[model samples]
Target: MTLAGTLRPQYDCVVVGAGVLGLFTAHHLAQRLDPRRILVLDRGYLSAGASGRNGGGVRQQWEATATIRLAREAVAVYRRFPREFGYNPWFRQGGYLFLAFSEEEAGRLRKVSGVVRSEGLPVRWLEPHAIQRRVPALSTEGLVGATYLSSDGVIFPFPVLWGLYQDLRRRGVEVRTRTEVLGLSREGPQWSVGTSRGTVRTARVLNAAGGWSRDLSALAGLAVPNTPTRHEILATEPVKPFLDPMVVTLRRGLYLSQSMRGEIIGGFSLEHPGEGTSTMPSSSLFLREMSAQMARLFPPLASLRVLRSWAGFYDETPDGFPILGEDPRAPGFFHGNGFGGHGFMLAPAAAPRLASLLLGERTDLDDRLFGPGRFLGTKAARPVEGLTLG
Candidate 1:
């Protein structure tokens, strides 16, 4: 497993997580500097956090214009990720179907359809019959309509991580596993990171530590307004390939996507926000909620035997959107966490823009809305409504 020399206690940049955001930040930095100057430190195996554990749902149907843009751009990168990283990420372009149970929900989705079409995405509004035809097993009892995105799809999370990790290593970026970051300090123009393995110095640091990002910001004397809420997802026994597009019900906060292996994998939102980062055994309440919601939308899954379930934290923000860009208090320390539930779909697009900003390049995308200053005293200059993804 030794791909390069041991850490030398110093580097040009040190990223403190190997999750999607951290890996992409380090990879983007390596694109800007010598590979030897970049280092990625992770506390667990690559993709072991929310990155690998997430439901791998990628879609462009968002209420916020910025969220839409981020997701649209990320989809492009994800389409080309396999060739760029030399491994197919199993990114299936099966599209996404968003079902509505009420006229209000249907009307809101109709508006979102206009936004999606205006943004040049391949989305269309479908009546209940169309949804029933596309997904024969779904129950259309109370359903009114749906927003269908032909370009939306799901990817297996592990191969994407493998491709990113191997690609970074091949470029001479040092990634250390099982290396927990204990502390950090600023020294003149550089930052010193104290870890369980040893200390390392870097000119800049990116805090892409997924669920632990808020804690890392505190170490730099920055109060980040974020909380890690736990979400659980379960799989059903392998079945025939009946479901194609991912089925989502925004009203119920329910989403279900079938894996390549035919296991229907998904979950529903909790009534209250989750507590800490414990990914303990799945509870009966979770199964009950998921089963009830699934039956209400897709009646076919009601009898599907549950295979297994797992949990991961949703690093949530006040607005249920991500907080991206450089830290206002600590310029050299950057942040790219708090995607709420869509970090994986936004990382590819966000990473390159962040890299361009760090290197003083001009980007057409303005990221001030996502800066750390927004949470301090500045309110969101623009109002974002509809489908906040809980």
Candidate 2:
């Protein structure tokens, strides 16, 4: 829905997408510049995209140092969000457990756990007995060991998005939902953005449109190597809260967590034909596979009924990391997409860091790590294969 403010012909900055990234980016921009000069445009209602469709998982466990740091900072912000914004995101520090069933998987976890520990995070290597003790419902057959991060947790995403949206509105930032960006072009020093509603001219534009980011970048004559893949998730009927921590099977790329409302919320990736973006009717394949995996892992959940299932797109990059920073060809355009499956978790820190970069402020995160320039190189084309554990 459009706000009461008059639509300006031009703005200092126009942020595309009203998801968590866009909302947080606009909020941070308001803090750095005049709030009235910033405008946020979304194709659909706020939180209608992947931001609201995720499984509400957050974790600081990552093999990359840059991602680990960003996640740590993001979790800290999530912990304080409820008190600071007067909105309960239902933040739960139930921890994240990554199970390794094979020697190869165990080795990978060991190596990554080293990096996690080096970053000063509390990560533990749990034996099968310890793993079984922690989650008695899980089957330990062929399970080598697991990595547990006590501080990693989950938070309800919609409240966080709503909180930011309300805060930005109160700070004078104009947020317009159902405003789709049709085209983007550089006109002298400013950008002329053609939208479904109307054309807007802005000195800078932040492309935070998630899965639609590749198309948005193409509109500016920039070809990004990001692909949108459908990821499916489901929730079961509310049962007694038995699962405290989110569990991930590293081998199968499966994960599940019992929410505060007692519904088991989770998803997993199966070998698809690498299909392009299509978030539609949930697949029976995903439901069957996920159910089988869940039942095998946690036998007690075998009889539980699934309430509903839905699909969302993952803006995946070759390196399994997000592409951030400004477009080299388009001077005023910036990127905040290709987050693979961890965009929601990284939003808290990534948005502010992106805003800092946009406003020319010093940031702790080095832009080179997430820069789009990496994709042009031979070494960066190699995929880091692993399921995002959160």
Instruction: Give the winner by TM-score.
Output: 2
Our tally of clashes for model 1 stands at: 0
Tens-digit per-residue lDDT, 1-390, candidate 2: 464445789899999889889898888899989999999998788987899899888988888888899889999999999897879999899899999999999999999899899999979999999998998888998899999999999889989998998899889988998777888889898999998877889989998989888888998889999888777899999998788898987765788898888999989876556565544458899999899989988888999999999988778887777877777777889999988778888988999889987876677765556876766656643445254643
Off by over 4 Å in 2: 1-6, 377-390
- Best candidate, lDDT-wise? 2
**lDDT at residue 158 of model 1 (Cα atoms):** 82
Ten-residue stretch with the least lDDT total in model 2: 381-390
For all predicted structures, in order, the TM-scores are 0.94, 0.96
lDDT of candidates 1 onward, in order: 0.81, 0.85
Prediction 1 TM-score vs. true? 0.94
